[model samples]
Target: MRSSYLQTDLLSEFDRLQQQVASLFGGFPSSIRSDRYGSFPKLNVGTTDDAIEIVAFVPGVKSDQIDVSIDKGLLTISGERQALFANEESDDARRYAQERYAGSFRRTIELPANANPEQVTARCSNGCLMVTVAKHEASKPRAITVQ
Candidate 1:
């Protein structure tokens, strides 16, 4: 019986430690993820020969609501997602699960050294914000002929 009790205690301690580690990294795992979980509007960054592209998936947000800016090698995206049921009858309604994040959110990304902050452009369509930053002329690759 004493051995069984020790085993139980050890199991509980292990479970607690697991919880702590998970929280330290981020909240409970979910289908949706981000650079920092719970941060609105997940984005993907990629580079091409002449430009860097950033696409932010911001569903349920309007193009007018979003604000994109670049300053000192940092690109920032800010916007708001209004609640879906803000005007609905809430007194009698109950929420079973709430996963969608609403309200204002902002995400800042550091531009690469080759990025040309002066040549940034952004457009929003189909619930996604696409930003393209041209690469500096000095950093662009060039083909050299064999001597």
Candidate 2:
């Protein structure tokens, strides 16, 4: 009997911990949490001697809706994802069981020191935004022949 009670208590504790973690990440603003699973948009910023590359994951959004810009070393991305069911125009509020997220979101990233603002090119392909900032001629790596 004691072992059964201990097992039940452990299960309850586990449930509470799980709920806490979910709530913590669930409240993350839509700007960062683009994924339906409460995961934030994943971004990778890398540098290769001549350029800097940035990739952001943004799903369920159209290419036309997204706007990307770079200013003063700041890369900003903004967009609005219209609600999926807004067209139905139903006023029923009792049918909701699970709602992940919806609406506008914006994210800003700081560019690297050698990033050339004017040479940045961005493209959105299959829900991922890829931005490449080519370095200026002066910043590109040059081979120094060791005599």
Q: Which run of 10 residues does model 2 get worst, by summed lDDT? A: 32-41
Top TM-score hit: 1
lDDT of 2: 0.76
Q: Write the per-residue lDDT of candidate 2 for residues 6-64, one digit (tens) a residue.
A: 99999999989988887987743345424454333567888898898888777777888
* Alpha-carbon deviation at 75 in model 2, angstroms: 0.6
* Candidate that would win on lDDT: 1
Misplaced by over 4 Å in model 2 are 1-40, 87-100
- What lDDT does each candidate get? 0.87, 0.76
Residues 6-124, candidate 1, lDDT per residue (tens digit)? 99999999999999998997756555432344478888999999999999999999999999999989999998888888633355667665567777899999999999998988998
TM-score of model 1 relative to the true fold?
A: 0.77
Clashing pairs in 2: none
Give, for candidate 1, the lowest lDDT window spanning 10 residues. 29-38
